[model samples]
Target: MTAHTATTLRSAGSTGISLPEAIRRADLGDAVALLASAKKYTVARLSGGRLSVPGKGSFADGAGVAGTSTERALPLSTSGPDAVFEARIFNKDAELRWLHEGDGLGTAVVLSESPDICRPLGEFLDPLYAVEQIDNRYLLWGRPLRSHDSGASTGPLSTGPLSTGPLWVRLAEARIGLLDVPVSRAPRENECVFLRTVEYVTTEPEHGNAYVAEERLVELFLAPPEQSKAAGSPQPDRLPEATR
Candidate 1:
């Protein structure tokens, strides 16, 4: 299939659009559709070759599965800073599981992976105020609340209290590299594997009644546990100004 670039809508006004709706209108479909189409290196298929485009029938596998009642344990490495941390993106709860198992640190870090799953997770979370839904399975990472009296400027607009929110391009440019790793064919229950080089876009809701915003070309990177920290740190706030 030919690749298509999705358009973003900023609000719920006449021409404004919600992030989810914009994604559908952009013809990119859901998270799976966006990921499958954006990354040429990843292989995706449908049961009958119907072409799983978003908003057209049931496209992605396990599209509406409920969240898993039980949390799965992730494998960690014991090799200190130099180890491999593997994660599975598919879960009934739509969560991304990060299992770090190598040397001495063997722990499972499970947050709302869906925040990281969508195209503009960073943009959404940088704000100071926004509403989120837990039943949606996908994590809605929103920014903190902003006061109308506090004059903070962002992006192209400058207002005393009404900021323009975060910049989408900066979020998209964050240098998260992608890797394709070999996944296990047959694994036990709650066990999943995957090849790397995964990519997807994110749509974050704006504060108040403004349009839902989105970020494109969000890349996923896999690095050594130590390298991942160094790369992800530095900014250590919301989304970095720029990713390598």
Candidate 2:
């Protein structure tokens, strides 16, 4: 029999709290079971902007950073009667490593920053899985999409090799632009791939200088088409966020 270990899901706050305990106290095992039934996990914020899990841990300092507010600590929020959680996945190293959610299975949510998280989680979950790192170099075949303002046009931002450094300069000269979104290159067709949508927040009052608090709502999706589907045609998955 495959041994099933109870994965600990903790809360975010200055005082560390146990999410699983709270869930038990609130009698929310049914809700948690419902979430797990999807074969997917979700991260969301609860009262006091504290991170709540179906099982262990409570809302407390997620990253152990001093003076960070609860709002800044957890970015994902719950919705409706079921309190479905939501968050935006951005590109960040630390947040990706610590806060993002993933199943022990060979699947995980790809947050915004550092596409490396996909590989890292993949390796952590399935040692036998081969991870191939791909530079963010692709075309934005449609309009830009923003999490806050869906109507606002951020323009087609380039990703991959076209948005980086010396390569960026050459790509810019060649008509390519900076990359806005980064995507993974593995988990071919029919495979379930996890994609995280993290929303970053900061205790700092200034919008420009605040730091990223936490990542929430690690999402899952089907892997895109293979090279055969890329015969001079843009893959739908490769389209701009708006189009997607």
Candidate with maximal TM-score: 2
Question: What is the C-alpha lDDT profile of model 2 across 87-193, one tens digit per residue?
Answer: 22222231222221332211123232333334432232311111122112223322222211223223222232211210100001123332122222212213222
Per-model lDDT: 0.23, 0.26
| Superposition TM-score, candidate 1 onto the true structure | 0.19
Model 1 lDDT vs. the true structure? 0.23
Runs in model 1 deviating more than 4 A are 1-14, 18-20, 29-217, 229-244
**What's the TM-score of each model vs. the native?**
0.19, 0.22
For model 2 the TM-score comes to: 0.22
lDDT of 1 by residue, 71-129 (tens): 12222223433233332232222322223333322222222234333333222333212
